[model samples]
Target: MNASRRDLLKLGTLAAAGSFLPAAALANAGSGVIEKAAKPLRILILGGTGFTGPFQVNYALARGHKVTLFNRGKRPSPEWPGEVEQLHGDRNTGDLKSLEGREWDVCIDNPTSLPFWVRDAGKVLAGKVGHYLFISTISVYADGSKPGMTEDAKLAEYKGKDAMAETMETLRADIENLYGALKALSEAEAHKQFGDQVTIVRPGYIVGPRDETDRFTYWPKRIAQGGEVLVPGDGLDPVQIIDGRDLGEWMIRLAEKGTRGTFNAVGPDYELTMDSMLHGCHAVTGGKVTFTHFPVADIPEDVGLPIWVPREGTPFSGYGAVSNAKAIAEGLTFRPLATTVTELLTWYRALPAERQAEVRAGIPLDKEAELLKAFHAKQGA
Candidate 1:
């Protein structure tokens, strides 16, 4: 089936499962809150066609908020229900001329990778927009720490060049490490431009349907094969992730509520360990699985290791445990972890066989089992 038909079929299937929401239900829960205002809030999202962007767009549209997207017009979205105003421009060239004189209630910055880009965008929208929401990463926290870390923790300081060439070189070398520092610097720039109006949402690994990146996709595919699972650590290492839909909802809620400050937008603080996370996936997929843990040192030098290994001496240090109390207190609640896993599995199964196989490559069940066994054995020895 073609992409369009496939999307329709997926939507139909999800709708039957009660996972999909009608546009009306997506509207504000009640008029007493931010929704009660006479005028529908206008929102501008930079990079609304990418993986996480579409979810935000769908959410805002469902809530009856008017949305305008600013992008280079290179990556067009498939058909969407509501009419979204598109502003064509490239952040690289700093050409946001199309957005001049247009003010919005909120602006979600999704595409900026560099501090300069954020700085320029903020300069343009500073006084024009009410709330400037920066979709930041959990990576901004110092490395290796997990659970209980709050948003005010020490941020990674990035002094590297913000231009394309320098940024690309650093990114190509180590994406995970570089991403946090870069994001921290970018957030700092945004704060400098728009202090109280800026809200930073630092989300942990976000996973859901239509995710182009295969980081979270590996687990579901692995479990579907029904075999021993390869676990990075003792399966005790903390893990946290937020569904894209939930993230989108909370972001919109934050805007509507006029919440400020740095919020760690993640899943529940409890039940955030590697074992529980994988077990959740296993239960949803109904796959027979056992975990084999590897010590940090014995991770084989291979092309396709699923786990992230930190450099020696840097072992899980900064922002290890993040606290979401602030967001929770501000009306951020996640669906059960089991629900997220189940939906993720459903989405995975809905993909065409060809696409499924492409992502499933380099993740054979036996190899995973073998690696897990080696790692576990080393730990025992």
Candidate 2:
């Protein structure tokens, strides 16, 4: 279903990007589209109030499935249906007593990065659940430099003989370095206990509304500001992203049919490039904007840019080129990139001033300005 949008300044962009957005997939949007609805089943979600989790819960409820959320009461979900049951426990500390002996038709593991979280929950949920769906990342892949990599590609490995078990603090300390490797470990734990009943989804660069991190949100925010935006590489570099809502909806369908195995959940529904992504943002923002391009070699390695990894001479050269054919064949559909841009701008503008100022990804405004100056100067020199 298409996410609802607000503050409609310009929608003409949707027409130009229509070719990129498939209308056949969304043929039932805005209308109650769950045909011959499957019998309602109970769905359990770990960390339901978080960014991606809410979308899963939202779509699950919309599809007539009941939801139960497991998390610390620290973040309550007022946006969700009031009738959904919620249980409290801390997964980091391995306190899963709240989930003991409880059963559901399916369980969606949304927040697990550490292996112990899965092992701890599996001990309790082993035969009690029908299917276990774990939300994972494309980061789990060992290499992205090779194009056309599929779901069966090499995965990042963690040594089994290592003496110490990974903890949240340890993962947090070197998150950028260890995240993928650890997610690989966690995926193993899910299957070790559940076997064929486990479904794993590996998404590339999850984006769109309610995204706390500025990773992909930076483009929409920067473009809407209407000025010289500093973008890395020539505008043709490859890029890939999946809206969080799209991924959530697909997972619901998977759970409904008891589909299992791995799928790469990245899309434009077609191949996409850096220029198309930026121009899509500009089209929706309706701004007198200019994108200043910098060569990949010019930007310092530590000055992290969001979403645009260089596709040459780096470990992530093929990052944006990961395949999604399997997922699409299995009914995984994507809304147009224009819909993502429009909905993201609407969501970002709704935030309070303080929260809006707290974007966690992308370069800061001053740093972006400094880089743009040096980029232009080098060209003039």
Candidate 3:
């Protein structure tokens, strides 16, 4: 049940900010309470059942905002703390008819990869909503080799024949190249449709509860098992991750304040290294473990390692170094890494036994042992 090589690469590339850790933010990490807005506002979320959607819904409800979700209604609804109206529609077939003539104070578009979704939504909710917020990714940037890349860096260009004609299936057919380009196009389309009132928040490596990818979760779960763990690099490479709740809550705050412009929503408020990240997870789990380090070149290409992208010589090396100062300036905050680990484990454990048995991501034990044996033999020789 080991994760595929593609999965590892996708997680490493697709998934930072800030230096000062907020005490109040840490205190409220596990709570359902937040500062209420000056006045209640109507909020519309395009997708509500995915990883970050639920957090946004829960936090918006906690802040006393009226919330509405528009989706296909395939997944069961979460036990929301307050009343939330659900509108059923599919963005694939251009079926946003349910959203026609609806008005809200703000609209948060999640789970949008195709540009046509934005175009179609604009057809319905154009002037009806006061503000539009789009959830984007750090991957939209063209270059990740330069450290400290900001929101103004060059964006990837869609090399395909026509951006508007691309679909999920076409993007999946060539994800590595198309995903970033298409997302960049989607951002432009958002600004085009929503005008200057649009807010673009690009986050990297969003890890927390309800995460089906298990990229960041793999480290905590593997380290908790207590044994020789395979770690990539010398442990000095920078690493940046934002909790789902932190990102979700900040988006709501931006909507409340009508914050505009693009921001790199990456973080711990300070710099973190791979060594520090793993040790932090172990500190919380109290797992008896030893980490064995290997150079990136020593590892087999097919054996995928999650959340350990090389700090040098790769296009995505800057992923761990992307700036989040813009987000921090806009009241963006992060929970401690330990808090994320604890809550993630709690959520994973509470899942059904059958679900827990499936290995979501990481190197299999047998493969790890084999790699370790070969590595040690080379060292001895």
Worst lDDT window (10 residues) for model 1? Answer: 8-17
Model 1, TM vs. native:
0.80
| Model 3 lowest lDDT segment of ten | 16-25
lDDT of each: 0.64, 0.74, 0.80
Model 2 lDDT tens row, 255-349? 99989999988886887898889998888888698888777767775576777756666666777788889999999988888888787776677
By TM-score, the candidates rank as 3, 2, 1
The alpha-carbon deviation from the true structure for residue 295 of candidate 2, after best TM-score superposition, in angstroms, is 1.3
Among the numbered candidates, top lDDT falls to 3
TM-score of each: 0.80, 0.88, 0.93
Error of 3 at 353 (Å): 2.5
lDDT of 3 by residue, 284-342 (tens): 99957999987677787677777766777876778888889989999998888988999
User: Candidate 1 on 1-381: residue-level lDDT in tens?
Assistant: 001111211111011111232322222222224333334689999877765666677767766889899988886453556888999998877788888888998999876667777877877888999999988876677643444678677877665554334444555465545666777788888888888788998876566665545556677667667766666655665555667667777887788777888888766657566677777777777857666665645555453433232222343422324577887888777767666666666666666677666742234656666766666576689
Off by over 4 Å in 3: 1-33
lDDT of 2 at 151: 90
Instruction: Give the better candidate number (1 or 3) by TM-score.
Output: 3
